[model samples]
Target: MTDTDSLVADLRFAEPDNPYLRDPGTSFHPVDELDPETAREQAAVLRDAVREHDARYYTDADPLVSDAVYDTLFERLQTLEETFDLDREGSPTRRVGGETLDELDTVAHVTRMLSIQQSVDADEVREFDDRVHREVGDVSYVCEPKFDGLSVEVVYVDGVYTRAATRGDGDEGEDVTEQVRTIRSIPERLAGDPPGFLAVRGEVYVPRPAFREHNRERVERGEEPFANPRNLAAGTLRQLDVSAVADRPLDCYFYDVLGWRATAPATAEPFSEVEDDDSRPDTQRAETAALDRFGLRTVDRSEHVGEIDGALDYRDRLLDDREELDYEIDGVVIKVDDRAAREELGATSRAIRWAFAYKFPARREVTRVTDVVVQVGRTGRLTPVALLDPVDVGGVTVARASLHNPEQIAELGVGVGDRVRVKRAGDVIPQVTEVVDDGDDGHFEFPDTCPVCDSPAERDGPVAFCTGGLSCDAQVARTIQHYASRGGLDIEGLGEERVEQLREAGLLDNLPDLYRLPERRGALAGLGGWGETSADNLIAEVRASREPPLPEFLAGLGIHEVGEATARNLAREFGDFETFRSATVDELVAVDDVGETVARTIREFLDNPDNAAVIDELLGFVDPESVETDDDGDALAGLTFVFTGSLSEPRRVASDLVERHGGSATGSVSGNTDYLVAGENPGQSKRDDADSEDVPVVDEDGFADVLAERGVDWPPAE
Candidate 1:
């Protein structure tokens, strides 16, 4: 078999007969260079590509190509169609999504949920602004985040949540009311005096923290983590079992009020087609405010810009802060603020003319892979990690990236000293997306023995595992570190350095040794850099960690398939350690998110006599506490805010204020930073970074204004 054929076979997927993908490098031939017949043939190829990608993205929730590649194909299709005058009926270009999944019940939308025209260039955004001005002079715009997630229409009657459906197509969608209801942020009942009948359109998303936790768990379990939170959220919502949906940490943020009806005023009109002033929202800002008033989550970052320049500025800021947000957003939705202006501007057959989706530039970066090294995880899984010539991906320096496995290495067709494309999207781990250089032919040798212990290594599916369990020093260190990690048991001050010290002293071997450290206080105190006071404090911290929340304890166990999110889900389902420990494969599989593969993994772990003994020993040293799932209302949760320069108060005071509001304040500016609070003489580098990343910089007063909105005091507590 050819290399591509071998890679395809290794992927365990049946390759589709795609015409456009015959040679991805030659997929697009300039329309101007091609004859009419050739152009038509190319158009046909592009049509197939678009249809295939749409199916992969919408129905399967697993897009085979990157958004950039898909967009390129779509643009080519549009060009060919225009050039050849080959516009076909029911073209994929005119549609919003793929065919509805058979597993989901279909529901026709009350009013069509049309898509927005997308543009990556700033010039296009400027043109859109100029066009709007030409059509309806000097109009204001409400710029909001164009969330990258599954779009859903939520319906309510008599202030009670009634139904919700996914945006499968423009006119119809898949009914996912039961699954959507499980999202805690989405209210079962509307707040205030809501309209008698209301329809709100929103994006169902996985928060960045939840997405990070989920992916981290997947990595620890020797599984390929999800590419992006948006895909995972969509896939979760489409699950056949509602219980599976509930297990996923999902949140919804309403963007548009599609329809509202009030009995007293007798006002009833769909927002999209409202004719009268009374029935229509005066401006986009008013509609968003109404959504917030009715107890729906609206984008707080949304701002009203007077003209095109302000809209562009907002767009830049959003790009800068893209990584800082908990949810994924592809672009800024720039809409004419005035309802009358929007009505006058009108819409196209597929999208609104009054608004445009100004998409952010693709985040992928191409860099040379200097070398490839094998890293052994706590679970004894060997993963090939790529060490790259430092590359800035989406405004972040990514030096090291995951190769996933030997199969992925083969599939990417890359080797050391080769130029490769790396992608950093949201909080997902930096990944080598593709091999760019053709000169390199040699691939990394998949080892037959463990790098650390020289133990026999065996491949299970795509993953290679070392036979040395606790005997492997690398595994032992990683396991100890995992136990002390933030999402695990969270033992204070027990970082890599301390874990290494303990390991070298022969005081640690397994999880139970952590709890027993206090008994050897004198031995710990005698160690270099350790004193009586420090030893006592360490012991106290270790003892305090005995009754960690059940989920954390489960995560600390380093189960093959159990990560923090899965552990939390399992903990929630089973209630306690006893139930989880005694769970059979059937019981485990019955739990939401715990499919047959995971169920078998868990059952096999528990069935092991050695693992059972370790668990029994650990149980005697520690008590598992019930998990407290509810986070106190954190107004600024998922926002990475930075306080720069000098503030009215001390920098610490301002930083503390941010923390109190549930937002993090970093000293440095990066792609992940959402807001930069700049005081007088703010660092030039920070300003430059903000400008480069498109992060918004606000004055000290502006920072205070945001705090006021969150109901937080300007001067935080000492």
Candidate 2:
């Protein structure tokens, strides 16, 4: 029998009969009426039963009991734990998740989590096979889907789940133990007798169906939907509230183990030395089998092959069935079966030599472009968008694709009525790639004037901008909406539709007009679909935002090239609105992440007479507070650090450490940069910049030495 078939057979035979399956309603008993011992015993039984049901549903995908019955059993278990205080750390009841974390802590991985070398060409795959055969000599290969989702490392101790972390930088990752505990597929305790210490790598993902449904619900509620399942899953896993993470339909599939120990260690050390056990799996296939035996969910579709041709066939078959799969996979991963062969091949700083990812071509569809229209954004930038005949690409019906700028349109020579090949870049944004047919049309001419407000449209390099700024109706509505968005002043009642409604009614025109709405409360309330209560609530929210943090105030302005991070940097650098508003380009360039382009953009926006008047008018009602700094030491006050590539800790943690020591941590390498901290697999562009700029490049250890020399601790105190 095949390995998957044998696994299914084993699961079927070992599956326990749930006592609550027949009459779930009859299983309930008041916790108060039961004795302590009775409650504890019943709770244990319920936990085992619930775990079995979960395993059947999640891992095997063959649930014997209905969801209602499972819920009833689970609810009863929770009640028993809450009432009689019979809760255990590994109980299934804890999956409901009420823990709140202030922030995710960093933890070291037992072993390095190296990336796989990937290629889109079949020749590259054959080349990799050649290299493997030259060293390992006719080794078997294991092929599995390369899941496109968040990678994490999960650790277990003595058959109980202990910690889980994001694959931040291979060496260390963000601790997400609380978030991972909520995934029902992951067992709180292993099903069979397992290793004392185990660290496995897996992908956390949202199933496509769940992702679509969630996005649909978000749209119905007038909230912006997530772009894709991978992004949604990553964002959901990072949520500080465990309850919120539990609410999302997140699942995981284990593929590889980083560390394993057969015997229990005396101490609670994460990675303790142990003699190699004969029972340990020696091949990739055997390792997966071991993972399955322990009740960890591994992909059942993976296959073992003796040659590269069989591996290629498996990849082709997976590509054919890609859309039907529950999770998103970008490619097929082929790994040398023998663990000893892998060890012999070894690895580079970034990737393993024994494994290679053969990626599929980007999903593309040919559709006729009906028209090209210019869209004015909140920053008055005009983006040419092509409206196309609706076509399905990667299961998503795409009707429009971005042309980006005039240069893109010219380069592609795309015109109305042209049949163009479109692909979803990063599987999220649709873009026109090539023209399949000219369709008997002349080259489309881009308009020289603003389409929205009939203002002068000026070209800056390849990009076109509407000089009307906030005066343009399209720009006005979007700008005001962004100003009140959650990332901005966070006015609760002012959503996209509401801002459009107010603009259509001529009750609102710009940012300052939103703050002036209380003066015209009667008119606002009398508007169609708006009542007195809604108007009052909106006015109150606007009033409440009269005094905002300096960062929020800067972000609310919707300046070109300025986002939340840059806004925060500006606020930290300038301290107050008056100082920031009057700053020249030279002064603005001193802020972290503010290059000449961004500095000039800031200066031009602040220097505009119309924009200055609007700001002055808004200042009559709004007060922006100075940003406070927590840096108490000037250890590295004059030095500026730019980080690139993977470090021992997350780049954010490293950046925070630098900022805490009164040093500037910028995103890019420039002439002003004092040091470029290059880690494993550093970006080539940053390294080139460091070389050209004559900036010193330091490794992680070198950075630590510099910190020591400055009298600052390497890893900051908790």
Q: How do the residues 547-650 of candidate 1 rate in per-residue lDDT, one tens digit apiece?
A: 87787888787777687657766776677898888988898988756899888777766765656777788889889986433332588878877766788785
Stretches of candidate 1 exceeding 4 Å from the true structure: 1-102, 264-280, 366-379, 384-718
The RMSD (Cα, Å) of candidate 1 is 31.5
Residue 131 displacement (Å), model 1: 2.2
Residue 190 error for model 1, in Å?
0.4
lDDT of 2 at 374: 78
Per-residue alpha-carbon lDDT of candidate 2 for residues 556-654, written as tens digits (9 for 90 to 100): 888877876688778878889998988888999988789998897788677666667778988998999886555658898999999988898866567
For each candidate, the alpha-carbon lDDT, in order, equals 0.73, 0.82
Using all chains and alpha carbons, the TM-scores for the candidates as numbered come to 0.43, 0.55
- Candidate 2 is scored at a TM of 0.55
Q: What is the lDDT for 498 in model 2?
A: 86
